[model samples]
Target chain A: MSRRTALAGAVAITALLLQVTVIDRLHLPAGRPDLALVCVVAFALVGGPTYGAVLGFGVGFLADIMPPADHTIGLLALAYAVVGYLAGLVEDVEERSVVTTVLMVGLASAVAVVVFAMIGALLGNAHISLSAVAHSLAATVIYDVVLAPFVVPLVSGAVRHAEPAG
Target chain B: MRDSRRARLVLALLLLTAFTLITLDFRSGGGGPFRTVGNTVFGPIERAVTAVTRPIGSFFASLGHLNSYKSDNAKLRAQNRKLLEELRTSDANRAHLLSLERLDHLAGQAQFRIVAARVVAIGNALDFEWTATIDAGSNDGVRRNQTVINGDGLVGKTLAVGPTTSTIRLGADPEFTAGARLAGTQESGFVDGGGHNPMTFTMLNTRAPLNVGDRLVTAGDTDNHDRPFVPEVPIGRITRVLPTPGQLYRKAVVAPFVDFTSIDIVGVVVAAPRTVPRDSLLPPSPSPTPTPGPGGTGGTGGTGQQSPPPSPGTTSGRRSTSPSPSRTP
Candidate 1:
């Protein structure tokens, strides 16, 4: 259990750092992938909803409060946690279809983006525009869908391997 | 039901924690414990990552285009030597002109004291426009509202000063504004940021004549009490003008000389030059051997030389925005 927690924390921290420093500068056609969000969703899919929520909150809070982050802290934490918890609830489903996985990630990413936008609006962040948010939401869903296949399996496999078996 | 009930309780608890953090962070305006801890823990790691990856990245990048780099290096070497000779001639001419301008007490030629800094990071993960982080901070004489500029023109103003770093809000940011005047003309106006579009400079008077391709520069009138920006720094060129019928003023789009996207190094105006007040009528008291002080040399030489980065932890003297009457330049 302790080893698993450490692995999760390390993955979360690495993803957060890369998201800000490396990923932000990539300047792809659509946008940068939300590696931090994807990391949380991956862990939750493997470790269950409770673990997902915990990881999302910790990682999101750190990312939000980091320097150069002008938004209100904890806004992403709530959004990511909700997304993670919901994604985790899908672990019990027997149908492990590709379409199901894509739909699940799509829904989770959309929820995260909209929640983040709504919270930003409520907090009176003038930079948030409904049209811009919708645009970003579309781009984010596409990017997350493409990234989910790699990030989810890698993180889940790593975490499960780190866990001590009976 | 029991398992679902536990999951619901967990979700509720996490939500409550998140909201509490938001309230605390909002009230403290980023001075809260969360931000402090986050910065303390992550700042060093970021510095390390940047330090390690930049050199490696550049090496591979250079290798990828070796033949092109070789060709460019040969061409640039000849050009560089020619430019160096021209620079020497210009430097001599500039010194003579500066002396005349000082003797005449030209407000537009006022010298300045500046601290040089390197841009360490660009936009955030969300791709927020017109903001960046620089290596210099309050520790290096950087303070909130100090104007930042590059070799080409004005970039932005320092937004917030951290202990070891500072955030700059670029000219393209929606919140940025500055007073501008047409080059070689007395027509003055205010320029407002237009985000993705070029900034709009509005002439205060409707009758003011504006022509396309006219240069714009900062209206750094100390007498008017403009905060932080040194007078007469280059801004940009007028690309297009909009004249509205019966409107009180005319607006033109200014294409800033500084390319906001590729900014690598910037200078912060730590102190304004000692200027003779514009209203003073007495003939400038001529001191024997008028040696231009540090402020004059540093400010005027900004475009001539790329200063070696300041040693870490070295800080310049802090000066108030109020123009000092010292005989230093």
Candidate 2:
């Protein structure tokens, strides 16, 4: 595996652990931030569509099978993969202003939540409700956006550092 | 252009694989080999991470609640004084009840064989599922569907058991439901979790009288094996009685005794008592006067003063009335 891929994998796992053990326990109002999702977006923006989608799938799969996960396996994988691919489509994302990048992260986070909720509804998940979906979407977007300034730059920078020089 | 096509292909392949896995896992009701492997692999890693990060987690949690600490401290001090007074008075009542129990061997509190466990991990907040992983598992005599409780009251029931850890669906989960009975009247009902909101209790008999401040406890299984919940584990108190005209059942909103958000220490009942506990587990009525009747008899007069209804939005830290001190057994 490439050094960049290994770094991404390590980062994703760390984010997953912290997300479940610490962030989830915070019991923040509305909902907790999706740290793994933000990490995926960061990796995607740095590596482009193909790399982003693959990393998203891997991270999502880990989340699905993570302990205490009662939801269907691969649900997160699907959402993250799609979001990663979409995030990579943003041209010159790294070159964009911090404000623009933050906006993109917010947009991607919102899309991921909507896609997950849509699939959950299709699967006849009994817990799905319009209000709940809206609440989660708002919370995810706000938290991810607030978190983007700190996480996105650090993750993307690490990925860039891990890549071989031209 | 080639890279774009390759990306599309990879995305499609991954999406297909995800969909396939989802179908298989869903059809199998989450008992697929993949899930087992996941439990075997990730369970240990999660346990370790939780142990290492618990201090840090609590630090942040305390920081988050820093604003409430001062007010909470004062409120707790006042509550402590009141509880101390109640304890002194309840001592005589407890002794009296013990004598009565010795007189009538059949009427006494159930003794549970419990395995104490610490909560290691919590379910993802993004997902609507409310579950927590406890450190105790089948290796520690924990089993699937066993009742989980804390000093406060009913926590939840074990869902999936690993060798050293188990997953419990919290009572606040939207899908969670348990049989419940009113503490005094013994009017049986079922409690339904409302996710982030308070639980709802539905009485089986439509004409049964319901009142605010009335407490509810686990009804246990009809077979008395206590598969999921043991009888008389204090569930919650009625906050509001919904007026359901023409409905076959009556519904009431319940504020559970155990706060689902910040549960840490828990006990899993490995073996239930030989006899049903009935209302023995409920916290003593808040009234200062101890009822003269036997523990089995309904004592409505002491608890008649209605506890102010908890606001609909507040879901945690509302344990204004102390639970009974005799719940340790």
Candidate 3:
């Protein structure tokens, strides 16, 4: 448990640093692949459903630190926790299907977006139209979907490493 | 029901947090968070960027060292000699230009030195106001009043300079105004900034022969020169000219040569070129020296100094809009 938490923190922090200093500059204008979200997703997948909630909290808290984010700071924490907790549902599947990975990340991404929008709505963050944000949402969904199949295995392999030497 | 109820509670809390964030953000417009995060988070990132760039810089330095190994010493010597000769020539040419302007404002010129600096920050357009940070400041002899300039024109003047950073107040800033002259005929005017509105250059009579493409240069401080100082350096070129009916002077829209927002590197004029009579700097030279002592003493000693010397009228120092005594074509 201790090892997993440290690994998750390190992986997530590295991705966060790169996202701000580099990926932020690479603003493809379409929504950027939320590397932090992906990292949280990966960690939660490996760490089990309940632990995924904890990882979500970490990632959500990270998002609050950026300049552009508005009120309802804890929305991310709650949203990510739920996303993580759900990832634990299929933790034991040995040979995860590519279709399954794609669907899970896609669904996860949609959930993340909806949660963010909902948070904004609650905060009365002037109702931004979904039409306006569709491109970013599309970009994120596509990126997360494409990344998941490759990422799940890597995440699983990392978790295997976390097991003690026989 | 129990699990659903807990999840709903969590969602409620999240919604509440979002509401609070919105209120804080709406009121602060990201100022508090940006500063806090900039220091805690972005500051480290900037430091890391510096660290990463430092290696590249050092590599370039070594590459420079390696390439210059053979000819560096000889090149330095030759460059030094050339610079010394060029300095002497510039000194003479500057004196000539000063003399021409001296025909207008006769006061001794203020000594200045030039230094080059690089831009570090360009303020965002969305929030506060636009400002730029230059790499040189007090450490480089840049001071508050000394202007920041690029090749095309004045970027702004130094507002504050630190050891490694300096903030420039752009010519377009509302607080800034400079005395300017129409280059073609050296007709003088005062230029004022009005935010995004077209900057204005107002002359007393509105009849100065201003034409499109006419350039403007820094007219030295009139307070110091009772007569408006002859323009020492070009600031910008006229883009639009408006001459009022029945007026003898006109105003023009000036497009500054320096793109204040995009400036990356600039040369600061260390000294305003002063063309004091050449004899003044030389000892016992040809130019008649003003005698020292309160009552202007000299051979004839009729109260020594020339009193009210050829009065041009009281100097009305241009307060940006200052209309002081001035002479030009």
Candidate 1: where are CA atoms >4 Å away?
Answer: A164-166, B1-3, B30-33, B56-110, B175-214, B219-228, B240-254, B274-329
lDDT of 2: 0.75
lDDT string for model 1 (A20-69, tens) is: 56665454664557888888877776666777787778878887866556
The window of 10 residues in a row where model 2 chain B has the poorest summed lDDT is B99-108
Best by lDDT: 2
TM-score of 1: 0.69
DockQ of 1: 0.30
Candidate 3 chain B least-lDDT 10 residues = B276-285
Tell me the tens digit of each residue's lDDT in model 3 across B1-329.
Answer: 01344544544555465456546654665444533542344333433443353323332232223222222233423433443454444554344223223211211222323455544343311111234545555555655566655444556676544544455656765546888765434457778653344566766545335556656666667555312222354466667877577766566787776555445445455455444222221112133322222222222437636443423233232234656658896
Candidate 1's residue-wise lDDT over B178-274, tens digit each? 8887654446887776554568898886765677777777777566433556666677777899867888888999888777766655666666654
- lDDT against true structure, model 3: 0.52
List, residue by residue over B1-329, the lDDT tens digit for candidate 2: 12488889999999999899889889998877776676677777877888687643432232223212222233323433443444444554344223222212211235665565667788864657788887776677777888888766888999778877788988988878999998766779899988766799999987556878889988888685678888778889889999999999999999999888878766677777656645787777785322222322234456834533334344343344558545665
For model 1 chain B, where is the 10-residue window of minimal lDDT? Answer: B61-70
Q: What's the lDDT for candidate 1?
A: 0.65
lDDT order, best first, reads: 2, 1, 3
